[model samples]
Structure formats: C-alpha cells, structure tokens
Target: MSHPMHDVLGRWKAAFDGHRPGAMAELFTEDALFQGFGPAVVAGQDAVRAYYEAVPDDRRAEVTVLHTYTVGERVAGGFADVTFSDPTGWEAKVHMSLVLRRDDNGWRILQYHVSRVAAGG
Candidate 1:
C-alpha cells in the first residue's frame, strides 16, 4: 500500500505541474506559512496562491521526496528536492522541507520552506 503522505505529495506535484495556483493553494492550510528562495515569509492561503501564481508560466517543477516521518498522529514532516525548468532549458534545483497536519479534509501543508541549491554543489 502506498503511504498516505505519498498521495498528498502527489497531489501537490500535480497541482504544480498543471500550473494550477488555486489547486496548489488548496493543499495548504488557511494560515499556512511559506518561505521560498527569498528571506521574506508569506502566510495564509491567499498569499500563498499569489506567490505561486507569480511564478513564470514558462517554468515547471519536479519534486522528489527524499525523506518523511510522522511527528505525531496528526502531524508529519518531509524533505524533497525540487527542480524548476524553463523552455530555454534553464534549470534550478532547490531543497525543500514541509510540515503537514491532518484535518477533517486530509493532510494539508502547514509550513513550507525552500532554498536554492548552490550550482555544481
């Protein structure tokens, strides 16, 4: 049987790959916290949606889960490698960490952080 968390991540990946910012934001909690490559942190669903929608349409991402573990009956954490690609063949890799919490609707991202991986590292 596949891990339930895998399904959650899969949905998240699909949303990103499909370029559906609303769908991506729906995977997060109302008050979720997000930090991308920048130092500024964005909070809440609307902000998250706006942040994702701002991503260039020419870019797409592939996410690979590196590790995951349950923090409690309702909380889990994981790490992933995210690769962003554009039509010009430009690519950038980022390391990501996520915290999820289960609610009546299922697991939703509570906290997400991503940082760019140094080139040639």
Candidate 2:
C-alpha cells in the first residue's frame, strides 16, 4: 500500500517545481517553524512565504524521502534528501526534516529544518 504522506510530499514538490511560494506556504501551518540552510529560524506562514519567494527563479529542488514515521494519529515525522539545482548548472544537496500535524485542513507542516550536506561526503 502507498503511504499517505507520499501524497502530501508530492504536493509540496509540485509547489516548488511550479515556483509558487504562496502555494508552498499553504502546505504549512499558520505558526509553522522553518529553518533552512541559513542560521535564521523563521515562524509563521507569511514568513515562510517570504523565505520561499526569495529563492531565485532559476532554482528548483528534487526531494527524496530518506525516512518517515508516525508519532501518533495526529503527528508524523520524516527526513528527505533534497537536491537543489539552478540554471547555471550548480547543484547542492541538503538534508531536510519535517514534522507534520493533522488538522481539520489535513496534514500540514509544523516544523521544518534543512542542513547542507558536503558534496563529496
């Protein structure tokens, strides 16, 4: 059987591939916490939208789930390997973790963190 979270991640990937920051932010909760490759940890949907909007138009991401598990009926956690590429032929790989919660609106991200992985590691 297929995992339900697969569908959720698919929507998230589609948003990024389509370069729609608003659509991407809609996948998170209102008070979601987001920590990208930078030192800053952002919270809230508006901030998340702003963060994603700053991504260069030429950049895109490909995600591969490394692990996933359910914490409970309302919570789930997962990690993914994300490869980001740009028009300049530059590519960077990062490890991403997400905590999702099920609400009336369905599964939404509550926490997200990402760290860059060494190219040759």
Q: In TM-score terms, which candidate is top?
A: 2
TM-score of 2: 0.94
Model 2 bad stretches (over 4 Å): none
Q: Each prediction's Cα lDDT score?
A: 0.88, 0.88
Tens-place lDDT per residue, model 1, 1-121, is: 6555677789988888788899999999998999987799999999889988998877878888899889768998789998999999999899999999999988999999999999898
User: After superposing candidate 1, which stretches have Cα over 4 Å from the reference?
Assistant: none
Model 2, total clashes: 0
Error of 1 at 92 (Å): 1.1
Give model 1's clash tally: 0
| lDDT of each residue in 15-108, candidate 2, tens digit only | 8878899999999999999998789999999998998899887788898998889977898878899999998999989999889989999899
TM-score of 1: 0.93
Clashes of each: 0, 0
